[model samples]
Target: MKTVLFDYGNVVSLPQAPEDVARLASYVTGAEPGFEDRYWEVRLDFDRGSLDPAAYWSHVYGRPMDGAGLDEVVALDVASWSRPNEETVAIVDELAKVGVPMALLSNMPVCVAEGIDTLPFMRPIGPRFYSGRMGLVKPEAEIFHETVAWLGVAPGDLVFVDDRLENVAAAERAGLAAVHFRDAAALREDLKTLLG
Candidate 1:
């Protein structure tokens, strides 16, 4: 009730990396996977430390790519981060002003997450739990439980917002109130109802 954990990417402002994933994907499957989740499915493990980038690229791209080639793909993947939402930023500020602490928990790459930490939107939030740093990812029991432990709050008292239903499900199963965030509006309403 006092602290809310937000998923990064959409909730917090992040830089847009270049997009080579699409180009690679098109070459691989003849159809580009342009969205965040599609690209993320392949990338999340690497970002979360569950898989190495070289191994992942080897499996996905059909061959191992050098660091540069891997970065090209990751840049494109990070670029999928859309522009930040001003309204959400405002709400975060408002919530902070009310003495409600906000923390960021994201399934993000170390490089990308570190880059995001330098941005203005992340300034008010507490130390971000980037999967890379934690060696865990969302929709997984360890990460969710680790987040709860790191926050020092009971799961039942914390609320988690993510864009994935599976993530929401995991959070709920762990005893946290969960919201599958759609947009600033939906997030606004969910926070009001839960935190009101």
Candidate 2:
């Protein structure tokens, strides 16, 4: 394969600090007692560019955030997305050893996505496709095509790995080979078979 598109959250990284989801749920509860389930929908809206981030944030909180509160929210949620998986990094290194051009494709918020440049793996991971930056989200079809275009590879020459089945299905629909990511070991085995 000439290109391998990777998903970051769950597939590559996770909440680094801890209790992030629970904390977010608590924050949402302050606005609406039972709004936690709505949080994911809001996040998806933000990622897919269906709603402007500030507007979404305001809607979620039921009020506009002060600059400091906004900064805190971004820092607490987006910037705290997580640390990289060493095993996944090793797999990326293995893929690199064979000269496969890899790109990261993730539904990430702009604040966290921008901080990706700080990662060594991300630096060498070819062009990253952050939904916030691209104003597109996966399962959308365009992102898959766009990433392939960015990598200058045919969809058939690319493999996409993501934790979400819908996202993987979308990759398949877009004519790229797809892998459903479970964990480091499963991913290692799958990639070993794919790239070995």
The lDDT values for all models are: 0.74, 0.76
* Candidate 1 local lDDT, 138-158, one digit each (tens): 888898898889888998888
Q: Which has the greatest TM-score? A: 2
Off by over 4 Å in 1: 13-41, 57-64, 67-76
For residue 153, model 2's alpha carbon misses the true position, in angstroms, by 0.6
Q: Pick the candidate with the highest lDDT.
A: 2
Candidate 2 lDDT over residue span 48-136, tens digit each: 66776567777777778657776676666665566777788878887787788888899876766766757666665867888887878
Q: In the order shown, what is each candidate's alpha-carbon RMSD?
A: 3.9, 2.5
Q: Locate the minimum summed-lDDT window of 10 residues in model 2.
A: 28-37
Alpha-carbon error at 182 in model 1, in Å? 1.9
- Per-candidate TM-scores read 0.77, 0.86
After the best TM-score superposition of candidate 1, give how far the Cα of residue 56 lies from its true spot, in angstroms.
Answer: 3.5
